[model samples]
Target: MQMSWHRRMLAAATVAAALSISALWVAPAQPSARNGTYFYMVMYRGGRASGPVESEMTLTCFPEGGNHPDPGGACMALREVGGDFGRLKIAHADCTMEYSPVTIKVLGKWRDQRIKFIRIYPNRCLVAAMSDWVLNFP
Candidate 1:
């Protein structure tokens, strides 16, 4: 009788262990589980109504590579500016002072934090001069 009781207890323990392992496999993925930051960025002439020249594409940083054409360059640019568009370092260029505006809209997650940003540039060249090709999709 004692031997049978011991066998039952062992069987219950085995079942519990199997259930625990299955639960782990079925658990939902957390945001932090992602490889890196993800963003959907749009570069358009004038306003959003003007239509995106580069539509919206996924951009990732820190081991970068997404839909963005130059992932490595874009990630490096963001790192240089510490992910702050307003703080982008202007590159030396002979940019005209003439105003023909271009706008950029970035909306997505960065470092697991939600983000929405917008900036306007005098022209495409001026945008290119700042933050390298961070704004240039292709």
Candidate 2:
């Protein structure tokens, strides 16, 4: 069957719009089990001579053999590493200790922070802090 050019263009446009909408609706992929467990640390820089002082907090998602270790669980470790300023070691069940750069941003409240890291297993991730002082797993 032969169709008019206008009709064809309209159909194409509709399909394109539908596809765009679907893409927006689709949920993001879940983080892999290997990348589940994570660590974080918060550091407060003191005076120039004093350098930086740090307070530690550990956050984990998995509860004793529940899939993979939670990213929140890793927070404490990360915080410690941060306190040391990238000199701390991170040991995982995978039995591998590696160092990678990380960025932590406070999203306000008790649990609205964002954490970003690269070349460290899972690549990119987002963590939200909760009122209970526990960070919400990504």
The regions of model 1 sitting more than 4 angstroms off are 1-33, 48-55
Deviating ranges (above 4 Å) for candidate 2: 29-34, 37-138
Q: So what's the TM-score on candidate 2?
A: 0.27
Alpha-carbon lDDT, every model: 0.72, 0.35
What TM-score goes with each of the models? 0.61, 0.27
Question: What's the CA RMSD for each of the models?
Answer: 9.4, 13.1
Residue 78 in candidate 1, Cα distance off native in Å: 1.8
* Angstrom error at residue 114, model 1: 1.8
